[model samples]
Target: MKKFMLITCFIIGGFATAQAQQTSPVWPGCEDAEDVKACFNQKLAQHVRKNYEYPQSEDGEYIRGKVKISFTITEEGKAVVESVEGDKAEVNAAAKAMIQKIPDMEPGTLNGEPDDRNFTVPFNF
Candidate 1:
């Protein structure tokens, strides 16, 4: 019984230590997001400009809409899309396409360690 208790205690301690070490990605709004928004916006814009797909509307006019793409930021500042939200079909496609085109970001940091963070990117055509 005593041996079992000691082993359990050690296991619990190990888990606690590991959990304490885990960190969350810190965004600009998350941590310094306000400071980083400009950088984020710039990067996002560059991505859109490079990847923008101007599909024609049913009326032969160009169609453009805003879409919000939500993604996770890795500890190394890479943005990984979790999901997207919007109405226009093309906008949704653009959101996914643009997200795929996003270069790995400088991962967000928390407690000096890389962490997962979520960010919303708005794509307007």
Candidate 2:
């Protein structure tokens, strides 16, 4: 939990370990948010909605599926996708792309030291 960026929306549900972390990431534009976790989720939702795009398959149909993405916020405060899992490779790739668009923020901390934080988000397309 010391280095986990847990969230509410599309979160890795049951990832209660984040509770042990010293501090959560200070999402960009959420520096003043009273509840860091809530703000993170809200901003994440907004980011997903703003960047959401459905990829087209070769068959001329939109790819529709769900993807689970694992990402890490590095000690340098940058979001990087760790992995993506989904039924369709295209959905997984698109989901990863959207997550990569997340802006950098103040890194989370553990034991008073900046640390890499991991977060999981799910996307339906």
Candidate 3:
């Protein structure tokens, strides 16, 4: 018999708040995307998968947990982590660092003016 483990991370999903009806920020290659929101979700999933690093406990065992990450995409198109909620501090920090790598994207609009977009998404590792 052969046995191995697979490590993976996934973004559960997120929303653009009440003003979601307005235009959404565009991901780098999603400029021409027909549905910007869907494109953004796909890009976010890819970002998390590529950047996530599993945290290890003091015992050297890989830690597994779900974190609710709250963040804002500023009017300047930067993604900033506001908070990370989880049972483990290590997991929280790892999740935060992973999300911090989200590349700058086109700023979303509210009432036709550049505005901060808030997103609360859950991630599993």
Candidate 4:
């Protein structure tokens, strides 16, 4: 009986931990949003399209790359760059710029508690 209880507790604890980690930022363009996400997505897309000025390369420089960056938003609603994957130089620079300039994203919530959240970005230049 004691062993059964211990195993059950472990399972429950593991489940809780997984749930906690599952918490993530509300995507900037979720369809369920009333208007906020749409507004931000539209504005952000414009900002990225305009701001990312790829350096000229001899091969008619073009960045056809996609970067997935995980970021966090502070409790006060600020985007923070976390990790970036893709072209080391350009992707990192673009990711940093996106976080710095993209307007605040609505912070994500978990278990009904508002908290900093993890999110991703994809860039194609």
Candidate 5:
């Protein structure tokens, strides 16, 4: 009986912890989505793929690398790029430009209060 009670308590505690997770920000068109985080990621990837363009090198050489970009989503649903890091300058510039084009999103919330959310995406060129 003691073991059963302990297990029950543990299960309830696990559920409470799961419920306490912060909700992810919703993308512009994913406001009504059942799984906001999944929908946001899908939309963001699609948007990036649609808008990505490889920069031409002056020396006519192919540049192959990945650019990692970090940005924040403000309370008012604006994307602000924090940093872009990569091997090639062109790749970094392209990554920043692409991130800048992301549409405004619905701010994430914690306990019903608006919260700023940070996101990182890597662009392969």
Candidate 6:
């Protein structure tokens, strides 16, 4: 009976710890939001729409492509773009530049400690 009780306590404690560690980063102006993930996505989309600028084509033709960007939000709440993958050079460069301009956010926390969080965004233009 003692061993069974101990095992049950350990399982419950582990689940509590796991729940405490699962938290998402807060974006600027979304600090008070109840759902950080939804708020972050909405703000990110708005930021992209506000900052994105189409690259100038050398041949005066419209360029259309998709860019996949991966970046990390540092513990200090700054964005550092890691990679921008796209078929067009201009698109990749534009996506990277846009991501770099993201405003600082509240750092994510895991187990109540500030943690670096990675995010990926896809831009189609």
- Error in Å for residue 75 of model 4: 0.8
Candidate 4: residue pairs that collide: 63-125
Encode model 3's per-residue lDDT on 1-125: one tens digit a residue.
12222221112123324334567888899999899999999999999889999988779899999899999999999999999999989889999999889999999988788888999999888
Candidate 3, pairs of clashing residues: none
- The residue ranges of model 4 lying beyond 4 angstroms of the native Cα positions read 1-33, 58-64, 105-113
lDDT values of the candidates?
0.69, 0.86, 0.87, 0.66, 0.85, 0.88
Q: Count of backbone clashes for each model? A: 10, 0, 0, 1, 0, 0
Which candidate has the highest lDDT of all? 6
Q: What number of backbone clashes does candidate 3 have, counting pairs of residues 3 or more apart or in separate chains?
A: 0
**TM-score of candidate 6 against the unseen true structure:** 0.83
Alpha carbon RMSD to native, model 2: 11.4
**TM-score for each model:** 0.60, 0.79, 0.80, 0.55, 0.78, 0.83
| Candidate 4 per-residue C-alpha lDDT over 1-125 given as tens digits, one digit per residue, 9 for 90 to 100 | 99999999999999988876333444445436566556556666777787766654568865456677777777656877888788657656765776676556556566666687556767766
Residue clash pairs of candidate 2: none
Q: Model 1 compared with the native: what TM-score?
A: 0.60
Show where candidate 2 strays beyond 4 Å.
1-21
RMSD of 1: 6.3
lDDT per residue for candidate 6 within 1-125, as digits (tens), equals 99999999999999987787747778888978888899999999998889888887878877779988999999888999999989999888888888999998889988888899998878788
- Estimate the TM-score for candidate 5: 0.78
Highest-scoring model, TM-score: 6
